[model samples]
Target: MASPAPTSAHTGRHLPHPVLVISVVVAYLVALHPGTLPRDAMTTTVVTTGVTALGAVIGMLLARWVSRRHGQPDGQTRRVVLGIGVLVAAGGAGLAVWWQNLIRAAVGAVPVGPDWWAGATLAPVAVVAATVVVPRVTAVIAAAAVALTAGLLTPASAGADEGQPLPRTVSESGTLLRGELSAPEFERPATRLVKTWRGADGLSARAVIVAVPTGSGWVDPAAVTGFVDRFGADVRILALPYADVPSWQAFISDDAAATESSIALVREVAEVLQGRPAGDRPLLVLYGQSLGAVGADAARTWLEDRHPGLLAETVLTAPPAETVAAESDSPRVVVANRTDPVIRWSLSSLWRPATTPDGTVLGGPRVPQVPWLPVISFLQTSVDLLAALDGPTGVGHRYGVEQAHWVTGLPR
Candidate 1:
């Protein structure tokens, strides 16, 4: 009889590793405790489960490829594989933690408890266990488990609130205008506000200012009021409230939706301006903060394409990494606080050196520089960001009284 095929442990499929499965489930449950992750429980569960399953499938594919190339590993080879697997899993865990903190900052959510840490710790442990127990299958299950755990633990955006109805026409004074416009991304009417400041010179040259609201629905009235106070009546301010989706979390998650809506709004605004006689047309200025900044930045290319030379300037304050590209031709200004974690934690700025804009102002109180380790930076900045949120106008994030001063510098 043919020599019994060399009995190989790796030759046949094996049952899932129990240790890996249990660790994964327990870790996820712990991280997703209601206090740890505040959101719609059912939605969280479904999304987390789906992500985990996808990760597992990807891991399995990677393991199979490795097995096909290397065949059954010797003791030493198995040890090497396990070591690499652990390192990769650990890196993944760290990344997940960083991302969680980033999202919390974006959505203005409170970060509570060390449940995420506990979940992160178990991720690598599960991966190593899975690799050792089922060498051929490797750590795919572990990866999947970790993904699910982390995802479930993250906070969800706040649901939209029933807002006051949009107004039909300009305010009685004619300096203020509030109304609604139709945009594809929004199921409800998009809120629009316009405040015109025709200076003592008698609106000879009108300055049209378009401001995007922050994550908190309408643009801060104080900020807008301040702008009008400084600019006088020559300026016309157009504002949009991004309240359809309501939360910053939703804004960040569906950036495309925000971008599309903004572009449409800008297009409509441009059409209205185009209808005016050339001599009467107002000089345009675009402004946004945080998520609003993101929307404004995303619309830059389209804005320039459709209405070249129309914009006097674009101001983005505390902008995220995604909006870091240089707008060399236009007067694009970036106002950032040196100590703000949101500005500092962005990996995009690191990867691609953000193009220094025409004007870059460092606002807020300085935060002492700390050692630049990934884990340390994430933890420190997360706390700092949360504290900044507590201030009356978001201390670090807000431009304070300096907004009008900066607006004065923009071209005519």
Candidate 2:
């Protein structure tokens, strides 16, 4: 007798595999071609593809492991299991969307636009493919493709330098003092920017601002300016470049080099201050934001030991949770938004108990007043960081407008 034809459910189970493979390829191509889609759209596509594919793979693996331990089920039972998997995946996608919307509403964040919808639609398909597709190897391949495409398409750093000549002298209007620092440890010349605000008399204070760049290495000048303005018209602002590469991965890889360069720059500034007359010297302050905060924190110990009273105050905004608190004579203020994912979902905060001294932490204006649950906070915080990228000042993780509030009580 001839073999029986496959059941409709079996045929249906196999259909999503080809569809998923095609979708992955198309998404990758769209991301690769700049004009085909907007830059944000491309990013959204890559992120969605990777996230969905990974989530689906994890779900499928868990389901299979459960089945092996419990014994394999009959065809009808398997079909039911697959249906549940699909429903769960769809539910997760829905939950992510709803959570993101909630965050946007709370912060008045810029809408993520239509590309988010496109990704939302594709996410469920990817999840369904993982659970129902036969020849499990195909599902693995699809997942890998999604991940690789996303990684390759993402921009590495902000690209080339501004190429402007460093200012030679301080002016009535703020002037950007630029210089190059070379060291054996660093691969390239470490560039620095000092925006000096000099009044008719002279400098009253000096602020060394370590910049936090976007994934593309673009720093928000407004953030630096706002921080400096809090100290009044006669404060000199020193801006250091941390992210020179194209992507966040490159910035992370170069962390050691960046830290070394930051320490060197801080030493240089300290020496400049030491040479000035005690009465004439400007009150010294150190400031950093996000990734820049890591570099600034790394230099704290050396600054305190070598020049005890050199730094009057230190301000850190949205610093990573892993940052070790260094003891310094100078007052240290850490500014964080409770809604910020980077701070809330940090491994240091999660694994370690609170050991930071009292009064060191200042609540940001935009932090949500929700109960702290690890899983929920992780999801919300991740979306918070994304929303912050294009969100308005003082909302979410952006601290340009709230700089005054955080720095007001600090010594000048």
Candidate 3:
């Protein structure tokens, strides 16, 4: 039987196992490839190095097994395998790099330099560069990575199953969910509620949505269309203030002004239906996402306290660290994704794992197997929050129709 060699050499008595060397190198490049979101340099480095080393160890074991059963190829077979591997590796590495750039382009990411095309040549060179590290070195590195992973998951796994409190937030997303909608005020100063949809007859609706925008504070036109298109008919009302505050900031800063504006918007909605009896009034739903979602919950609580049974539905997406307390049997949705670091992050998440979404509104874990480790999960998830909006639609903070879809499905 023949022993394995490094990717850089076919010299000495043992030749490199083409499969083993190729597998590890391929894995490193693939891991570097962007996911639903882009990663920063530090995260890219951590991810690539960990995956590369782990793949190397697995490749070594598999190669050894193949050698024991079938023996290593020699002469022409050996040379051919090595040649083919080099070609394949070069192609695969280049492809993965190019694919990531395409994603960057889609998101309008600023290039490292204006001479971006110059980086194209580096892909093929990576095939050679990737495998220069000795297998033993990679094996050691893999051990360290495993230890790190375990340490972080320890905190995440604690109290993961024990839960009594109701929900909260996805995939990694580097792209921002951008929207272009005008925010013109109504008759009231600083307060506005635009009618996004009306029945075909142009006179009726079953309910009205006091919808707030995502953290960016700009309502998405598609979302307005969604409520009407999905449900066949409903008057879609978007809540806004004349001078909008960026919604994402609500996470770090206590924007009492914005929260109060949201409260005022709900009150205006109630006034519009003042003369009608409670049973005859169109169902009022307070809806929001991220910080907006948090505000919606708070506003609902305030409204319910003053006028019971006014808010029949409340939908929140990607709410931050805490949930508001309410005293009502109103139906609501706390859309959450297992992979969403935003929902997974909090002081409580240091020991308690994220709760799963209850019903169909984008429920279930996007990355269910990743266990939560105490401080580690918190830190890792915190990093994930950087590019949270970059994920695809309905992922991370880029929710679309699903937010309303879940509400429409519920018994109204």
Candidate 4:
């Protein structure tokens, strides 16, 4: 005969085990993380479900460990464990919530998180799943860790150019030259080419402009033309339009092998140009925006260090202070919007807020003046990077098409 009283059994069905309860609590609490962009209801639900599912797995593992170590915990022991876990979790969550809410107020956003109804529905499913893995209650509580990733990123962020339109002149007459420079890579178009013309000095010379494709694995040929057209007939453009595909991994990775390759390409170009007679050698110019700008600056630094006087131009748009130190004195031209997060965000931002020194680069009108809180400021800036180029051409991180004036107007 089977017993009818399943409730009286030692299973923690009605009353969740300490590990299960704490996992659910911490899971939902972490789901409140203030992300960069505002997510819709469906996104929140999907994210919450994933987080809950992950938390449940960890909770089950901890419960299993405890069961093996000390057998099934009694109801009193479970209650005590739950009390301590809940208190600690609640205290930390309280501080995080306060900071997140502060960020919401600063960024002109409302509080965001999973809804109560959704939590009520999915949380139990997660708990039940955990309980299935370990039928008896245990004292060990599980900690859930979640990693947020972007499904889509802008070309500026990812160093990807979906469609780069070339100027009509590129197909028309004189069409500059091709194959004057190249990178040692398996890319479709390693570098753009250009023909030489009479410079203001009454001498026929070429200027090779290397476009650092912003942490991008691939290159945009149109970027070469953007500056090439400005040269009229005096420069040869050697911008890279490599065939490598760009991804967020390439964008965030510290090593950024693509960027390093660009530096190597620049070095190769300089070595070849240096081999030419002093007066006949083509002038080298480095131009890039955002991550490209960082690469451009590094290329110039290398050239200046080894082949002094090899570089003729340096245009770095919206470079982060980390790349180009805030204290350095260099002739490099930097065009940066006042609120461009790419230029401002850093690890130090967690403690120090961004301040405008005298002569802020290409300083535009100031945006919202919000109070900065430690961790909240860092989180806010992190998300701001995603939407940095969503604004007008002159605002945020977009510097527009007239970037060649600074270089073109210089004496060559």
Candidate 5:
């Protein structure tokens, strides 16, 4: 005797897993930026979404056919299948087109996995269909698709540009020529600085203090000058961009290879500095707070290895441990406060003690404290944050100086 179709507990006629279907649809929506993969944007999006949607539809139909073969046709099951299937189709189409340009610019091109999208949706759809078709093989295919979704759909940057930009500025004079220079990786056409102190002599000639603000703030030239005057060093400022594509918080938590991206960025900045026209003996000092501190340490390390004689010193104020490298042959300085909110929240967690059974605690934190960390970190963060929130538009990260001044040193 032929058996009737199983019914849902609520509607009494085989309802599909709406929650599972919705989850799959949403994941696909989030993951399906058009040009992220290596192929042409339109083509990749169309092919990826189309194939997955087709697989889902096929799985749905197959499930229905098998169920009918077993003489079980239920209204509730049909309605759920129809509704979720439409969602899959619409979402795929919309996402494939909406972010076509953004995905291309942000993520670039990449290889596609066989089950990237289609595979993800296939499994659950097959499961819902299985209530009717009862095909064991179809269920297996669906599971495989879900596994592929987890593996293939996450966004990763394609390694493309790694070289320095043209018009390198090695000295404050070089900066004066160009008004201001942009840092290597943090290029934004709108947020550039203009250097007005061109041809101004008697600037500090002993050391060039490159102050990188911690948070996402515009570097103030006047404030930089103040620091220079206080410390008796010529200051040059480069307003660093936000730490990463993901938030600074995300970068701190070690999520999604954020540190790796940060390293790449800092390396690019070093390359820019190296390409500048500074003489063989010019001093290059980097000062940073918070994220800028982290970036400074990274830039310092890269400079020491790539161009040994270039980076004279590095001064960090309240940097994350990951941003702090071990004491290198180069002159490196750390200035940290015990009470900075970010230090307590982020660096504290990073530096926590982990002891073995024998009381051997390996790899204790190594953020050495400098005397000026409390003041330096606070001042740097405050100035940078204010500038970031409010744009000086014409000038770079420095407070009063024109953005053109590249490298400034202690007064001659």
Candidate 6:
């Protein structure tokens, strides 16, 4: 056999594989601390960097293996390498999806970027494009990854921040007071509003409006303000303070305790009102969201069972219909999201009763009371109403005296 043509200048002089560089960069990004980016940015960066790097590594290995036979002067080797490159890219993309899902379960599912699978699928194509145009594709992708991850630190271009939480309260004039609830009322941040805007004209004259927030944990007090501005009519929203609980997780998980505690708060507030000058005739509208919604329903049921003529109306947004009794003739409107998995999970507990018709009236075991309507939307309509522009303004839980969707349709 003719001496095998001395392995040409190409012998062992293989160009550094692009895949190796890409993989290293990806590992670096994934391994980096997540807190460096804002909540949304963190998800996007981690997913992209992880997927791209993995794809590159896989592509390089495949290319090396396929080069043996296709390395002919005629050029079959280039074709083989190209085919292998595609396969490697696909594999890398698949891995990215898997990794992202794992991360999601670990942290609560906040909005990351596009779904992991979709991102991974596109990784190979991006790599190919980078390879053709850029001398160091790996470095370029890495740089892009860093930029994307870091960019979240910059406020969004929309001039509004969806990721950053809203302030707990705002004035009708539009001032944002951003911060967590105080130590005492952490469970129910809405309580702070009572102290913050007590002097806003007509507050003392208006009927005492009780806002029973869901859970012992805190939600943005601003949401409460939005609700008050939208629906409160000549009424003051008195937010309950957070009760001392071991932890947020415990408060949310311990439904019975939450309900009992909330009921006590409502009763205490009611008693205080009862001692006032016009307390007996005061129009008490019990309102709440999610868990607080249930609390409002239960409190109404208690009043119907005990006081009879105490409350005027109860409006619950995303209320757990099952936990609530049907003794309300006070117009009740419920907002639900078709896409919120949370509603389904929470409302189905054995402690809660089956849902009755919206207009059903209840008394003892004989009759049911009140009207029930399910307002459906993709987004949590009630939450959106509060968080979105048509909501409240200013800061420190001050519910503007304006009207919005949730309040506009009420039977004023």
Whole-model lDDT, candidate 2?
A: 0.49
- What is candidate 2's lDDT per residue for 1-412, written digit by digit as tens? 9999987545555322322333343333222221101124445554555555554455455555665787544455545555654565455556545555555556655555666766656643554455446537756776687677655553212222354222233222252333333323322333223323222222454444434333223444555566556655545555444444533454457655446756766776677678878677776666666666666666666688898877766666665555546454567777765444444435443333333432356444432244444343443344334434444455445556455346644544
lDDT by residue (275-388, candidate 5, tens digit) is 557763235566655555556666666666777877766655444434456565666555432222233232333234211111111111122222323332333222222222
Best by lDDT: 4
Candidate 6: segments with Cα more than 4 A from true spot? 1-204, 216-223, 226-234, 243-252, 272-280, 320-329, 346-411
Model 5, poorest ten-residue lDDT window? 354-363
lDDT of 3 by residue, 1-412 (tens): 8867544333332545756766676665555444433444445445555556556657777878988999875555556676776676567556645655554555445433322322333322342244344645644655776687655422111111122111111010111111122333223422222221221211246766766554345454445566666556555454553223344444445545445656767776666566577666667777776566666877777787776767777877666654444233567777654345566566777787655334314443243233456555565565566667555664445656656666743453
Candidate 4: lDDT of 152?
46
Sort all candidates by lDDT, best to worst: 4, 3, 1, 2, 6, 5
Off by over 4 Å in 2: 1-71, 74-97, 109-123, 134-173, 181-219, 240-243, 275-277, 326-328, 344-388, 408-412
Clashing pairs in 1: 197-233, 197-234, 197-235, 198-233, 198-234, 199-233, 199-234
Candidate 2: clashing pairs of residues = 156-246, 156-247, 157-245, 157-246, 157-247, 158-216, 341-381
Clashes (N, CA, C under 3 Å) per candidate: 7, 7, 17, 1, 45, 24
The candidate with the higher lDDT, 2 or 4, is 4
The global Cα lDDT (0 to 1) of model 3 is 0.52
Model 6: ten consecutive residues of lowest lDDT: 361-370
lDDT of 1 by residue, 74-131 (tens): 4444444445545654565565555555445544555423654653454434444454
Ranking by TM-score: 2, 4, 1, 3, 6, 5
List candidate 1 segments past 4 Å from native. Answer: 1-176, 181-205, 244-247, 275-279, 347-358, 392-394, 408-412
- Candidate 6 similarity to native, TM-score: 0.40
